[model samples]
Target: MAVRAEQRVDYLALDGEKSWVDFEVKVLWLVGVRGRFGSVHGMIKVDHFRSAATVEAQIDANVVSMRSKSHEEWVKSPEFFDAEHYPQILFVSDPIPLKRLQNGGEIEGTLTLRGISKPVRLNLIKPDCPGESADNCPVEAEGSIRRSDFGMSSRRGTLSDKVELSFSIATKPMNGSSAIP
Candidate 1:
């Protein structure tokens, strides 16, 4: 029987070109505040994670947190994310399907945020390691979308409708490694 290895969310993008994909996933968001940026981080529980890979991870209000430059503005505004009421965002994928890319391969996935789920897919164009390194095979994939769909209308007039979200994550074999990224 052929061993069909499952893939995970490796990395994501910010701005347009600048991105990070070295064992970490980050969500960079822009708000109405100047010099203020917000981020969310989480690790994929690969074992608890289902393969064939249709999975849905709820970013718990307790587990996932966000930060802003000013505590007053951050705390007072429902216009911004109400971490108290709606504390979790959801990312649900339907058994990620891979399509062979011209360079390597690509994956199509779905992500849900603010109680809204949409089809999201990324191009996993690079293999984990060159010449087949299953042990330390590195995988890089990415995809994006507009935030308005989820009703994030704070900066609707100012923020770009084309909120591009992308990621680059490298997965290692289940060798009792730590999930601290």
Candidate 2:
């Protein structure tokens, strides 16, 4: 929908200190390697009149913590995320309905990892609080991606190709602008 000048647009900044992205990949069908990315930054633009929103987020793959030091090194190595060469994982969502972000639904977007961009769909969980108030309730989402899709094809025999990702994001209004009423 065309954005009208008279329509309200609110901007929100993702709270890096409060937001986190967690991932898990099963190994040998029995073990799971779980980790989290500490540095996450993003912005959201909401057009309340259209009841839609879009978001762009960057995750610092280099700032990841795993179950152990060796696991951390392995995940950041050439076999997995390859943080040394590709330091950032990014996601830019197509305009999603505000109701999907507040209630539960699927959100389609583009995910870039190891320099490869592909379409992704994440399942959003209904928030506990009313509206899109990140202070009262974080936006929760989860999805799965194939490692081979991002060129992380090594260890296919022992490591599961599918990687599960979960995100809990908190946001603050940009420049003190409050959410649309």
Candidate 3:
């Protein structure tokens, strides 16, 4: 069955275990640094029959984690995310039209980072709605963005401008029941 507007799935209950948001960027034009936001919350409403979906998400910038302490601090600094000023990275899709494949599809949306919003297209892989519950679904998406476009122009030559983003989100009905882990 298709999910209606009233059946929107909540993402807050899926943090850490069932949901994750991560990114990667190259440093010194060679070294790859990977990082992940420790907290993320969102909602997704899909109209399966119409192949349409709406996604709204917020990522906690303050909780970003990296392999090294220095790297983590740098990412949260004014030159980058500036978590103190912009505590959240928000994303709201523009009534995405899903082109369903055998197991996955493509979804386009707008991502706002450091107060800058830009259009982004995510390649979904193995997105699925398990069982008969439209509220219980798993989604995976990957995309990329340019740091310079978002005003994150620090260490221009030392840090690569391209940032790759990937996320897995699982949702459950928000009818006072616990989400699946």
lDDT of each: 0.42, 0.89, 0.75
TM accuracy, model 1: 0.49
Tens-place lDDT per residue, model 1, 1-181, is 5323432323221211121321111233354222212233333333212423233334433232224436434533465445566666555554443323214554655666555677766655555455765334434455556656666666555555555443433333333433322
Residues 1-181 of candidate 2 have per-residue lDDT tens digits of 7545547788889999989999999989689889999999999898877889898999999999987899888888988889999999999999999888867899999999999999999998888875645665788899999999999998889989999999988888789554444
Query: In what order do the candidates fall by TM-score, top score first?
Result: 2, 3, 1
Best by lDDT: 2
lDDT value, residue 104 of candidate 3? 69
**Which structure is stronger by TM-score: 1 or 2?**
2
Ranking by lDDT: 2, 3, 1
Model 3 agreement with the true structure over 1-181: per-residue lDDT tens digits: 6555444433323444567799999988788899998687877655554566677878889888888999899899999999999999998877665554226667778889888999888887875555645335656788889999999987897889999999877765544432222
> Who is ahead in lDDT, 1 or 2?
2
lDDT of 3 at 172: 58
Candidate 1 local accuracy as lDDT? 0.42
Off by over 4 Å in 2: 1-6, 130-133, 176-181
